[model samples]
Target: MSRDERGRGTLEAHRFYIGGAWVDPIGTERVTVRNPADGSVIGTAAMGNAEDADRAVAAARAAFDGWSRTGVEERLALLRRMRAAFDEAAPAIAAHLVREVGLTTMVAEGQSAMCRSHFDGIFDLLPSYPFSASDGGMVELAKEPVGVVVAITSWNAPVSQMLCKAVPAIAAGCTVVVKPSEQAPLCGMLLAQAMDKAGIPPGVFNLLNGRGGDCGRRLAEHPDVDMVSMTGSVPGGGAMAAAAAPTIKRVHQELGGKSANVILPDADMAEAVRKSVFGCMMNAGQTCAAPTRLIVPEDRFQEIAALAVAAAEALVVGPPDAPGVTYGPLSNQAQFDRVNAMLERAIAEGLPLLTGGPGRPEHLSTGFYARPTVFGPVPVESFLAQEEVFGPVLSIQTYTDEEDAIRIANATPFGLAAYVQSADPAAARRVAGRLRAGYVTINFPPWTAAAPFGGYRRSGNGKQYGVWGFEEFLETKAIVRA
Candidate 1:
């Protein structure tokens, strides 16, 4: 582990973690890790290539049979040890997130803490999970490990996402090779350290640091890998699907979303609007399931737009390290540019911009900081409402009635999540049922960490979290007596 002597915090992954150890990269080229807050080089990670991917995949495949046959109690014991290591490194993980992705301290900490939840949540479900049952005759059926699994995660939530795929796959007795986003590879490095410290058998868990198109695609396409689970953009997911197609491996994707948050006229406008803005603007609006589209009653559009503006104003957007800075810069230059272009096009299209547009927050002359933007009552067909901006931008749309509200909410091609707010719980729940989303809620109910989290429609296939996620890495087998 290399530290930024400048005190930016710990994380400079110099090599790949394969076969349960840190090994030197095959290529000398490196991806420079930067602090998004001010664009300073934090550290350098050795860039990986197809050779690196082959090595990691081979390692996983070599150990697959033994790991796949390991007793459930044995795997759980090791996972608990790995979880303990994660707890000790939570602060450092949060620190790395702040510098690597510009997530504010609070958000970064929350993201880091989520890694533990994934472990415990899956642990809670694994014991009770039905791996085998009688076939109601002289036969039996069982769920067995699916062999090698490759987990490719995005930069936004690296650690949690990695373990979200790895923990469950391991629990299901599947060996895994994780190719985390090259943009935020430190988390992968950190996880590798934790795995090594926990004494996880070599090759049961492997980490390769590289771009999605390079080593990521190699692992996805490798004939030996039994499945590939990716958390990223629709386009990225598409590419992965295409790559894994010929291999005929299972692909579980938790892709992009332009989630809708519908606010019924009878709901508390101020509080609901406040929650919508906060949810949208969190992590500088980089979340996949963020409620970027707010559907409100047409009659209350103006009133709610003003409320949204007030909420955006209350959100502090500036240097991530500054105290009280709830909002920070975009994760990288590419995302910063994409969000700015989207904002510019929306402005040029003459949309009614309620607040914020096109550039850094006025206070910060440098950094990738963007203004907390909110576009009101935008047309449901507009890209602002239909596309995933993946930044701290909210597009509010007007709904004529409950039917129109559900229609507007389901208008997007993506359906990762949806939100509904109403004075009556029954009404909210009723509206939520009509929405075409994997996850729906009336008011922001307390999150169930173990709840299955995957989407319908283009949001990608398979469920994640708890038993649902654990099963994704398993295949059913039926054994019969003659």
Candidate 2:
């Protein structure tokens, strides 16, 4: 394990950050974090229970009054300091993610950078934000913080997810309690360290590490928490909503998706196919909004399938530190097993595996790695096309026409994101408008942190990113003039 200049390991495993101090969990049970690349134990984190959740929520509630009343300038200053602290800690955060989450160094660094970008984005938008507005008549409209926020983030992209929730909540003048996934809590811990270094006020920000059942449930059920923003499975979000229903707290969820990449016949087939394959294989296909379903024209199915197979086969998967490795293993053993089970089920159903299926790559004898697989002629109703495998697996389905493509794309319960590729920008934009997802990419546009991101339907509700995300934590009020 790599150590910092102070001779301390980057992954601080024993304490949870609450009320601006590192404290022990009430429960003694622990979760062992393993390096997925080689199945080696990295460290053990103290599993928090209901008591821990309560303590964290109490801290946030205590801090909310003062924090929420702070002026916009004050909040912007603190965010600036946070961005600086995050920059200083980026290297350590990247290293820790590589060890604990099994992400390649490149991907890990990008994720770390996104944390700082979110801070920058919010800070830039806060100046011009309309916190208070005047009605032309006898009333004025004002936006206020929604009180203490509970941010429950998933394992994949922990840094980005946590910040996407926490930063915006803080920007909206709300105190936050972050519950990071136990599968990869090290990055969250590192973020806490950055917050500490930035001298953020006590109780304004806290971190709790534990399973979803213990820490997550308690936080969701806690009356002190006014909002629960989460990024995870659909069922997990449902449970959180149910837990918070009695209190009627606001619940914003960015849940699972089986997003589709629709390629028009007029588009450059080779380029579209290559990018689509990369989108599915990126981050080992663990991204919540990954384009896992590739919808193509009936006549072009075989051609696209061949291109996808070649693209998937060319990817180099190995240890995070290995030379030329494009990606790493699944984040944990559970995900590894789940991906394998899905592959086995697809094979059992006689789906033709174009390149990979049912096992680790030949070069890898052990570890939680799965082969980068692509299967073609997948029916829209097939399990492979509907459920999220959350691994490096891609399923290709054919569409008779544009209408059929839209139908197949919207067939799944998920509506997180969609992709459209066409020779004409106007046509792609029109198709993008027709998609049911909350976000759509036309011809692989460069990712902009300023764009609003979220989902529709079963993928979950609420937006996160730039101004839209900032507004999610604010409650509106109207004052009538006498």
Candidate 3:
């Protein structure tokens, strides 16, 4: 791992990573990567234009000629090397995530662990992944690469989404050109270096750091790009689909969510409240799958509200590097403004703010800090309950019964993830099965990287981080012979 003067490890910043080479964008447009903790300019990244996207697509298309023909064993060995390279670079990347992205040390460390786990999970599944099969006496089925894949990822979970797509894309013998969110492009640069260090062939993996309107749009519409994968908001997915429609490229998307966490009457209210608080507050609630909505039985409203409000109010919000500071600043000023506006609307609508309200913390006024807001006795149909805040704020809605709880949870336009806590395992399982989300957690269970992660409804289509994730980049072709 590389170390700086402070003895903290970090990745060397590259403006762009294209065709296995670290280079600057051909265009003059650029964007600044800022430290959300203080809004300090970390570095200037090359803002890719249409031309850069064309170059990346061309590179991937060229590499597909040989890379896709490799045997499974050879591909597995190459992935193993890439995994080892990633392991050696984990510390640097983790530090960058904390310093640049402004997440708490613990949360940043956890993301790093998840990145490693994703690779391990992919490796474990590689041996068994179906590549070819004989269907009949003269017919064969082959899972072939979908050609040049253009992947766009969000700033909140940059590394996780980037690698989640990259690992599986490479493993499936597909070539990829990634357009990482300009807000968090450094992580992609480091990851590209790791791929290079692992001796992956030139042009198989390429990265362009720029605004979605520039590099991202170009990649989506590029004729050479055979498929497009994106993880962001519904608007982002729609834009990608619109761009790729003319070319008819396969488009896979995983978008925003207002996930629900229901606390059954018989569940442990205190424990459930604690986990819910942290789960929503982690990374300052920037997670797409975070349990943002807390649905509880009306009988336990007072008790649950008391615990949840106290938990939210007591959270330590400050600079990401500050010890004991669990919550960091919002990703950008735009996000800060949106959170502030939402809070204002909530207060104006008579939704009681159980704990926090608006503005930065008392002591530190420079950073973008949102108080750990909690709203109780909120109407399940209110905009605050149905919309995604994407901040440290949590909404608590009381329900009349189990059926009511399910109704409120399923009311949102998104169906990304759901959570349930019940005394009886069978009851929780039943509730879990009933939730329309792509994935649900019971009793605050741990997240597994090996499991499929995605959404249903408007949340998005396609899965990531498992065997299902691997298949997202493959196209099945059947051959028939007389």
Candidate 4:
């Protein structure tokens, strides 16, 4: 169970970055890191405990005062260096993601690239950002760092998630102690190395490696920690918020999503249906903002469903290294089991399966791979459409008109993101505006990092990415000097 082993698994996984140095865990306990593509144990990584969380938080608290007072220019310069470190580590990050999360190298690299793109995007906001403003020339409204931050990121996009929270927190002059998802710890380790290589001030950036029940819980419940920014399941976010509530600290949760994809009557039917399938299936449908629910015009429901089936059938699911794989297996067995369970219930309920169903893709004899499934004639009120299925499962619902389409799209309680497709620009924007999501897409456009990202209602509170993300780590202050 030694985490010190080398080769494919990063050695630092066995250790932690605390107080600006690499340190071993408080105990010999280790967590297994497995290859989802093959269901093989990659190696064991250090399993942290409450003591480790204590040490990491103490370090962050100790460094916060000085780091917070540092000039903005100094922080930006250090981030530039950190961005360079990320550049040097990008390849390793991408390579490890393939084994850690069962993503094809091409897709993993895209995830890895977010390290740079996110940092770059946030950097653009710093120069023009409004940090201080006068309130009617009577008082000065200044923004300052919120204080010690604990970032608990999900495994889906480990490095990117860390960068989105930690980078912005650091930029806002707040010290951080990050606890990456136990499901994917290597990328977080790699990012810690990047931070160290960039010569970040000790304790300004620390990484704790452990399960949510262990060190993760300690970090959330710690009194000195000013805020907890988490991205994961709704339950996980709720736990973190509850833990922090006693201390009355700020909690930002970027939780679950069962986002909708609305294909309007004016849209190209074939193209829209294809994008819906591909979009929902990407990352094995683990994305919190994925459009898992598809609402289409009822008159052409059968036609669109057939096209969706063709698209789903065309997707090749296999090992991450295998050629021509449209996507890989679920990150772990739990996710695979969860996905199949939901699918089986639908089948039992006599739901129509346009393509794929309850099992692994036929070619995927092994591994935690679920077939890329697409279902049609799904009732908008059914669990298949109502619940958040973090798998490559698409549920299609029919809509009678634009109002019905909008109604169906907003039917879900979760409103993290929604997609609208239409040939008419005005029509697309109109629908996009009506959708209750914080982030909406029109016609499968590229995901821009500069835009604000968060959800409305139960999806989660607060925002991330660009200035919105940076602001979460900051507190507003009013100085009277009139």
**Clashing residue pairs in candidate 3, if any?**
none
Quantify all predictions' global Cα lDDT against the true fold: 0.87, 0.88, 0.85, 0.87
The segments of candidate 1 whose C-alpha lies over 4 angstroms from its true place after superposition are 4-11
Candidate 1 collision pairs: none
Candidate 3 TM-score over all chains jointly: 0.96
Q: CA lDDT of 373 in candidate 3?
A: 84
Model 4 regions lying over 4 Å from their true place? 1-12
Worst 10 contiguous positions by lDDT, candidate 3:
5-14
lDDT of 1: 0.87
Query: Where is model 3 more than 4 Å wrong at Cα?
Result: 1-14, 136-138
lDDT accuracy of residue 301 in candidate 1: 78
Please give the distance, in angstroms, between residue 356's alpha carbon in candidate 4 and its true position after superposition: 0.8
RMSD of each: 1.5, 1.6, 2.0, 2.0
lDDT of 4 at 290: 89
Best by lDDT: 2
Q: Which stretches of candidate 2 lie over 4 Å from their true place?
A: 5-12
Model 2, span 386-405: residue lDDT tens: 99899999999999988999
Worst 10 residues of 4 by lDDT: 1-10
